[model samples]
Target chain A: MFLVKIYVQLKKDILDAQGKATKKALESLGFEGVQDVRIGKEIRILLDGRDISEVSEKVRQMCDKLLINPVMEDYDFKIMEVEK
Target chain B: MKFGVVIFPGSSGEGDCFYVIKNIINKEVDYIWHKDLIKDIDTYDCIILPGGSSYGDYLRPGAIASKSPVMESIKEFAARGGLVLGICNGFQILLESGLLPGILLQNENIRFKCQYTQVRVENNKTPFTGQCSKGQVLKVAMAHGYGRYYAPEDVIKDLNKNGQIIFRYCDAQGEIEISANPNGSVENIAGISNKKGNVFGTMIHPERSSEEILNSSQGRVIFDSIIGYLKGVTVNGK
Candidate 1:
């Protein structure tokens, strides 16, 4: 078994509106000197695979097909072996 | 001509769209479930993906619904030059399906905006806008949280050059300005069409404002335009 952790975020050129709102709230709470804040999502998945490399390929396809919006978002994934 | 309204698991706009087509527009309409693969897609002259938080907007708005079986058939339908209209969440699905360019992000103010808004018709050549005069401002209602339309500079340029930009947020007097933008879309874009002009997606709910009793029958012009085009009305000699 393998556990995959994926992180998705808006592309660098795109504005993160939610992140900006959270930053404003943070500043209001006295967290000063913050340069910038960007927000994204993290998704975890478990899969049964024969090898890590094969699992990595499947995860990439999953991201491209469904997990991320290619027009505005980028994604990265990490896989680790786990006991069934 | 027949129309099909796709209903995703969490779709809430099908009833409104169905009503508008069956009652207001007086046409044949059917509800297509998300899981159903439409074999007779060619029979429908138009298909509508209406507004709502499909799949409860899991992961992202329209993300899951875009991958549903019905979307595949809709994609094929659009490829064949069948008119496709996507409103609000439907617009988001089109983007996610890659049937339309650009992406709809969270509103700049990070708030859900629901109000009657004005949009100017930028191009009347499309089948969806043939009944509207160029630069005519139509009053429509927009309700969504992620209504900000965004694209790369090159894509925006192409859209402008090709007249794919169908609608822009404008004031009542038909002046495009930042103040009239409800969700901070780039260049105040409220709606757009694909290069072929058969696929259109807009943030505004034309069906909601389609009745005189609603105080704005202007939205009916869009449907009328479609009906006219299907009936072989040559738009701008196109």
Candidate 2:
């Protein structure tokens, strides 16, 4: 078994409105010296796989197919073996 | 001519599109459920992807729904030169489905805006805007948080060069300015079409403003344009 952690973020050029709003809220809470904030999504998937190499490639394909939109977002993933 | 309004799992605006098409426009229309793989898609002259949060706006507004089996048929429908109109959430699906250019992001202000706004007809030559005159202002209602239209600079230039930009947010008098832009869309763009002009997507909910009882029936022009185009196609033996 493997647990894949995927993080998807808007492209650098795209503005993160939610992140900006959260940043303002943080400022209102008296946080100081905050430079910037960018929000992204994290998805975790647990699946059975043959091995690390195969799992890595499968996860990448999953991200490319349905998990992330290439038009405005980029994604990366990490896979860890787990006892079934 | 027949019209089909696609209804996704969480689609809340299909009823409105169906109402406008059947009750107001007096046409043959039906709901195409999301799970159904339409085999006789050619029976319909136009297909509408209406507004509202589909799949509960999961993983981005239209991301999940764009991969549904119904969207596969929609893509096929569009490729065959059938007119497809996507409003609000529908527009997002079009972008996600790669049927249209540009992406819709959260509004710059990070708030869900629901209000009456005017959009100027930037290109009337397309099938969807033929009933409207160039520069004609339309009173429509917009309701969404992720309505900001964006694309790479080169794509924006291509859209401009190809006359794919169909509508721009504008004042009542047709002045294109920043204040009139409800959602911080690039270049004040509110709507656009594919290069072939058979497919269109817009952030504005024209169905919401389609009736006289709504106090702003200006959106009727969009429906009228589609009906006009379908009629022309029929007359031309298509």
* Fnat per candidate: 0.88, 0.88
lDDT of 2 by residue, B1-238 (tens): 8999999988999999999999999999989998899999999999999999998898889999899899888899889899999999999999998999889999999889999999999999888888888888999898999999999999999999999999999998999999999888999999999999999999998899988888799998889888888777322112
| Candidate closest to the true structure, highest DockQ | 1
Q: List the residue pairs that clash in candidate 2.
A: none
Cα RMSD, model 1:
1.2
Clashes of each: 0, 0
lDDT of 1 by residue, B151-190 (tens): 9999999999999999999999999989999888999999
Cα lDDT for residue B64, model 2?
92
Reference contact recovery of candidate 1: 0.88
Regions of model 2 farther than 4 Å from truth: B233-238
Best-fitting candidate, measured by lDDT? 1
- For each candidate, the DockQ is 0.86, 0.82
* Range of the 10 consecutive residues with the lowest summed lDDT in candidate 2 chain B: B229-238
lDDT tens readout by residue for model 2, A19-71: 99999999999999988899998999998999989998998888888888887
Q: Candidate 1, after superposition: displacement of residue B171 in Å?
A: 1.3
